[model samples]
Target: MKISELYVYPIKSLRPTKITEGKLTKLGFRYDRRFMLLKVIPGENENGSGPTLKNMHIPEYPEMGLFQTEIEEAKGESEGDTSRLIVTYNPPSSSDTKDNTESSDSEDSQARRLEIPLEPETATLKPFTVTMHSSPTTGYDMGSRYNDWFSACFGYPVVLAYLGTNTRSVLGTLAPAKRNNESWWRIWKQELVLPSNGHGNKMLNQWLVPFSLGYLVLNAVSWCHGRIENGTSSPAVAIGVTALALTVLWTVVNILVNRRHEARIGFADCAPFLVISQTSVDDVSGRLDGGVEVDLTKFRPNVVVEGAEVAFEEDFWAELAVGSNGNAGAGKDSKVKLLLTGNCVRCQSLNVDFSTGKMGTGEAGSVLKKLMKDRRVDRGARFSPVFGRYSFLGGEGIGERIRVGDEVVVLRKGEEYTVTGKSASEAWNVILTTGY
Candidate 1:
């Protein structure tokens, strides 16, 4: 198959920016999901009166899709000159509105533009923590000025946060567990230290196992002494021993199941890359009433390939090599190789009609409903219909550049290859045996 399109979302849940070519980084495209918007409760604070920050998305705020983003390179000839991300607010005209009402004249008087430094001065920005899908990572607050812009657009309190130099790990269970020739024991040992880039807090993650093991040993010794001296086990001691044993067991299991998947992500929801076949989009469109052609942008794929002979054939692709030649045996020499980690789960965001800033009631809005009828195929995320495949950049292609029209080679395919939320060992084995 050949790649037909590529896209990146600088800010999570906002409009996607299509690119003719993109650089592969550990965290997807270079600028993909490097910033995000967080909803702030008016009277809330971190002291626990209420939530201080919450994630915003198109499902809750359909107008988010109307916010267009453009990247402008710096023109100044100075070392301090930096590119800027320009965001503009453009509401639909009266004819495009679902309610047939014109946008407010005042709101439309001028298209408001918010300019943000593509690479902000993180040293001066305040550190912030943002969580998604229970995975928390560090972010830098863009201060009151940027917050005010988003807050005014939504008519509520919100804050814009930059990912800065920090990196978030892929959901542990979804990450690949093994390297090409590494053993499980080696991976377990490596897990004791920080995986991915060293941006993760060492005190919080790296030392967890040592402290837990120490505590378990101390508790065991105390319980043994108490039993020997008293010649009887007290109820409290018995309970303590049971709890400690369970804790240690859980810790070890977590190290095995979660820690080995060391893939890092930025603000993107899951893997670094998401790919979909154009034929699959066409198939979904054909199923829609009146054959309404669904916009490929709605799926939000980082890579779109067009030469698949069958719809949904990507479901069987365990690994892919993207380069000038479509050869599965290209091995590490391939410029842009990808590991297909899992299926991309769908959400109600697909029903959003950007033109009207509301969920469409016609064929477009029913995309999710149609897929749910037969596309609930992934056992791991069964409730959500599968659309695209989530992927990670292969070790060989980390710094490579991938462009549109590149040949995509299916390196491996099998029925047992899909991620089912079980242990990652099976997936790792597939990667190793297939020479990924």
Candidate 2:
């Protein structure tokens, strides 16, 4: 099956975009951990490097997109500053401007900038101290836990997983389809689900107390025309994947939408964009304030992983190589099919710091530099099951990758074979090993 849809969350609890392409990096993705989280430092010298992450109960920042942000590799190359992504957000408004006006005027802006309008609660930043990780290629070790930071406060480092044909096709047919209640806000608020309403612009600005990890459902639609959220799912709203996708999280009975009127959403009304960003395991790593998302200066993980069904779905790690690390040649697209027997779960992010062999806590100790600067998980850790708690392939949930375009070969052993999707470097993603 090809990728039907893709999604990414720039901030933890806010809405996200349905993106098509992104940059993959060892810290996760290039701009993945660019921004970070912050707690109000009670009168300290230079924020004590910002945020007192000393095992504080503050789970995450709900709103972290209001302020400004930037990252510079040299601080002077671009605009006399290092090469880095600058972030900022707008406050919430009841007017239709946030919905209709701004969107109409910015169609040309998205080409040169990532203008995701969101609310914020606090703000703090660093010049070039961010680190990241991304992808599910062949050699990527899964169990290595490396503390991750991000563009916003998020629970995991995520990439958009999409099957364009499926997602777009569903919107085409599901009309005259059924649906549950349209009270999406109440449902999501109660379920603690994040909103992927369409254009990936939902942001949270308050505290998520008694907070539990929540996620939006990104399903692999079989027939976009037939699989409508309120049509087949949402009978009670709190059902399994149905409610999850539409942000319906109430404990009501499942309710299907009456197949009478076809509620069509125009590409302009709610275009999908993926907010691909990194996340750390610390409770404080995924919170929002006003709109800014920050890291608690003290948290760290071992390994980081990025997975996608549309592009990097098969033979991911195997098909991938760092920009300057190897032959640096593009790959061909191929496909390998496998049976996913378990229930479909769409929310998963991996981050660990095997750097010290122990997943350390608290800002009591700090790694002033980036995660790559740490020698523990990066070099000292062994590539064993105990350490690679997560692997690029051959494990639970994380199936193997298969190319799916053109220009390629077929390798096999026993009942296994390989597939490629493209022949160009710009699109080449991964390589996969088949089993059965």
Candidate 3:
């Protein structure tokens, strides 16, 4: 099978973009999760040591987004090649990665950090202020697949995408049998409250023999029926009436079993793959000093490789790393572990703004929890449609953000897996084996 889509998110809680191809490294996407929002009033963890300002970048700060970010030491440096961890936020702090930094770059960024005085970011970045930096490739597709879409659609950044091939099968298998047993009634207060399943039928067709051919045949059949009944009666009308009438009586049963399909690998010819972060001599300081947020609406992620894609993230989050393979953390393997399972339907009640990146009230989150009482999605945790910083799947601490130059490989089923960024070791740590 070939990777068909990729996504990434730039801001901590903004919308996401879709991308066709991307560069992969151990930390994750090159530009993914570069900035994040730190809720200063955190209800539960607010009082915990007051979050010592060091080593952390808080979105609440105003002047933080003043510079650009990149990973100078991400990969490909020879013995004499100079590659240092570099962050160039303000112009003055900008320099070659070969320089001996640490105190130098910080001092420079701090000096030029005075533009947005009214904002949280400041000139000194004192009181333990932290900064974030990332590679340019990281910003590739930080829009299309993020939770911000849902926020605009429903006032919460909730988005979900499935290998149309995979989700359709899962829903078909689960829907037909369940619907036949009146399962829709269980999910909703009444069967009448359900939204009409239009495109949903498009999915069930995938479960049939020769899905592509079946869909073609279905279309052909609809055409012929209408042609024959033209002038006298519209067969399209007849079929539509029939389908509705049938639904009222016998609920269609789901008989498909062990459905399987693979995406054509030809789509990705000059594409990128999930990478390994084994190259230890890195330019860690290359990314921290970036400013200015782009309108993610410009990017789209349709072709993703391994597990890392730009413009993919949930609301209120930046990076998400599922395993320690080539996608996140450190790894020498060519494979990647997914930070999340199936697409997460977000809590609109927990909706976070897309353009402004403002988080909504806690009550919205509560509403989401109530709505998820029976669904497979996680209720207590937050999630984004695209990939990002805080991984909600692990319930807050599930996973950390993924960045560029991270390594990863294709995910397979029934194989031993190790999640990235976390210390847990077990077969279950495998995010998802089969698309099902």
Tens digits of per-residue lDDT for model 3 on 58-165?
Answer: 122223233233233324545113432222233223355544654675675454332111112222232222221210111111223332432233332322211111
Q: What are the per-model numbers of colliding residue pairs?
A: 0, 147, 108
Candidate 2 per-residue lDDT over residues 244-291, each given as its tens digit: 544453232223222112232211101111111122212223232243
lDDT tens per residue, model 1, 63-88: 88888888766666852348778888
User: Is candidate 2 or 3 superior in TM-score?
Assistant: 3
Model 1, runs deviating above 4 Å: 46-51, 74-81, 95-111, 178-261, 324-332, 422-436
lDDT of each: 0.75, 0.23, 0.27
Instruction: Please report the TM-score between candidate 3 and the true structure.
Output: 0.25
The segments of candidate 3 whose C-alpha lies over 4 angstroms from its true place after superposition are: 1-4, 37-350, 353-373, 376-411, 414-436
lDDT of 3: 0.27
Off by over 4 Å in 2: 4-18, 41-51, 54-60, 64-88, 94-436
lDDT of 3 at 343: 29
- Model 2 lDDT, residue 313, Cα: 26
